[model samples]
Target: MARSYQDVLAGARERIPEIQVSELAELLESEDAPLVIDVREQDEWDEGHIPDARHVPRGFLESRIAGIADELDAPIVINCAGGARSLLAGVSLDEMGFRNVKSLAGGFSRWKQDGHDYTVPSTLTPDQRARYSRHVRIPEVGEEGQLKLLDSKVLLIGAGGLGSPSAYYLAAAGVGTIGLVDDDVVDASNLQRQIIHSNDRVGALKAESARQTIEGLNPDVSVKVHPFRVDQTNVLELMNEYDLVVDGADNFPTRYLLNDAALMTRTPLVHASILRFEGHASVFHPYEGPCYRCLFPEPPPPDMAPACGEAGVLGVLCGVMGSIQANEAIKMLLGMGDTLAGRLLIYDALSMSFNELRIRRDPECPACSDGAKLEFRDYEAWCAGERGHAEAPVSA
Candidate 1:
């Protein structure tokens, strides 16, 4: 039967029950709050909408509703600028076998006129939309996840080999702030693996050189250069400032110090160590998974664990490990995917092989165990065998 728009809206209203704006507002605050779906256009939604409302848009309602609402019997409330569109949307949901569906009688306009609380969403500008178009297209890391990345702050313990690739990729991915802690200056020899530095920048402070490189790559990222070594005195203060730490220190003292500080500050640590023809990577989420101390109760003897400078490392190995660290850091920030929290990843370039080892948190861990007292110790002395040691774990 041919019908006018009014006739169709009248039929929808007859089929779908409508709840008044005042009633809906009270329902939102209740324990049994319904899933609020805003069927407004993009511009309308950006201006303002009900707090905790999920935007499905009237056009995509039928197609995308299932993903947002898992169960057919779940309570749902549809809303739009006025009441007509919400009524129509409720009819569609009803036809789709949704048992509990209601329309907001006066929609967002009435809700706002009634002095109800609303939220104006933060939207990306045109430049940001185009800049992170690739990331926005991803289902797991859409606009919401990208915004989280843009608001995050990460700390890198070195501006050398591993820090170079991690910082570069993180900046390109739109990480808002990156803090580089390095007292060393760039040297010509570091160019082979430390891609963030150039031959012309030799003798420049590593943190400053890396900051310049990151700024050039992505103007959206702010780089904070800390031209000082991280020690017990300043490690906690530094860790407390960032959301997560990427451990790229090549020396045992710095690595151990970062591990302890990370635990004390309850910061997630993305750790990677590159040696000749090999690399190791893992994430240490405080109290959630095994920590660095849990993996290695004691630092290996100086003779057994040689620095890359003393033992030489493959130039490409740093890129692989550092990139992994960045990946882990992003996952942690987004709170998505299974991170390497309880696992150790070992990569061997010579054999072209990858291996994983499960890491269980030590109940008696000196740093992360239940009721364990976390305090900074003389990491340099401990690593150099000046302090008492225990049998180190066998795996990397």
Candidate 2:
């Protein structure tokens, strides 16, 4: 005989340990807060859930648990829209060898009904309120959303053509912290497209020059400069320090490294590349969307690709694509409209037209798949003969 939903839920509750919503609220207030996981669908989560709750929908819990939590012995609390689903999830976690797991009794509804506080963005200060008044006026980026942008951190990989425009716009938009990584010195030739650098700063370090420019544009922004090339040794740690990474690197080696590093840390990467009058931009969010490796599993043959210095690029192309990158980053920080997460936007200045193509995550992606493990490798060695094909270093 088939059992009803109630019978199934009753059986699940019998095997799982549960904590009252009121008690959980008290525990949350204490210093030792348990790791709370919300097993609701995205829509349900968006409506309202616990503050700082790790969202692992019931359907994807089994696949995502290990990535989210390494210490199986830590106190873990699971919840859903109602008490029933949470009990079921608790049972599953217990079976998965997770220790000290508890289901939240009555779930979020009960917590809300019991007068327990829910999550909301903190209030902005008077100065911040005034500074972001225009952004606040926009419905999508109201006071709350503007606060999110102010709290966001974005790291840029290069201070050349792409990074120049992107950094300027992001700083102007009030991104709280901007990290720049570039080891080259500005040259006279860079003035054509690398607008952030001035002719007087020809020998100045790219990262430092960009920092000074951004600081001048917006004193509220904090610019951190990594005055060295990003390699396997420092790439992972550097990327971890920021909330998001913008790939404005001019070469395939750095691009590939950033892609792999972003996947390993599960950080979102906003990537763009330009050559001649054509430019390409996309967002790579590991697991949730396709990664750079998913699109280009391997770099092109050394002789097949030409660098910007060799093939030449239109200065305006950088502005167009880099500005789009900034647009995506702002939208991501504000949690606003759709991003180019799973789509590639291609721009052609000659035709004066834009086109888009969808990108899909590779189940066997060498860098991002759950079963795959990728470590940092010598990108320079891999791109040995392709040095000329890399994005050209900008001259001031």
- Per-model TM against the reference: 0.87, 0.67
Q: Find the 10 residues in a row with the least total lDDT in model 2.
A: 387-396
Off by over 4 Å in 2: 1-121, 385-396
Highest lDDT scorer: 1
The 10-residue segment with the lowest total lDDT in model 1: 387-396
**Cα lDDT, all candidates:** 0.90, 0.86
lDDT by residue (tens digit), candidate 1, 1-396: 899999999999999999999888888889999999999987899899999998877997898786678899999999999988999999999999998999998899999999999999888787888999898766567677898999999999999999999999999999999999999999899999999999889999999999999999999999999999998678888889999999999899898878888887899999999899999999998888999999998788799999999999999999999999999999989999999999999999999999999999999998788877777677766788866442231111
Tens-place lDDT per residue, model 2, 62-146, is: 8778866788799999998778888988888888999889899889999889887777436567677677778865645655577
lDDT score for residue 180 of model 2: 95
What is candidate 1's TM-score against the reference? 0.87
Predict model 1's lDDT versus the native.
0.90
Clashing residue pairs, candidate 1?
none
Clashes of 1: 0
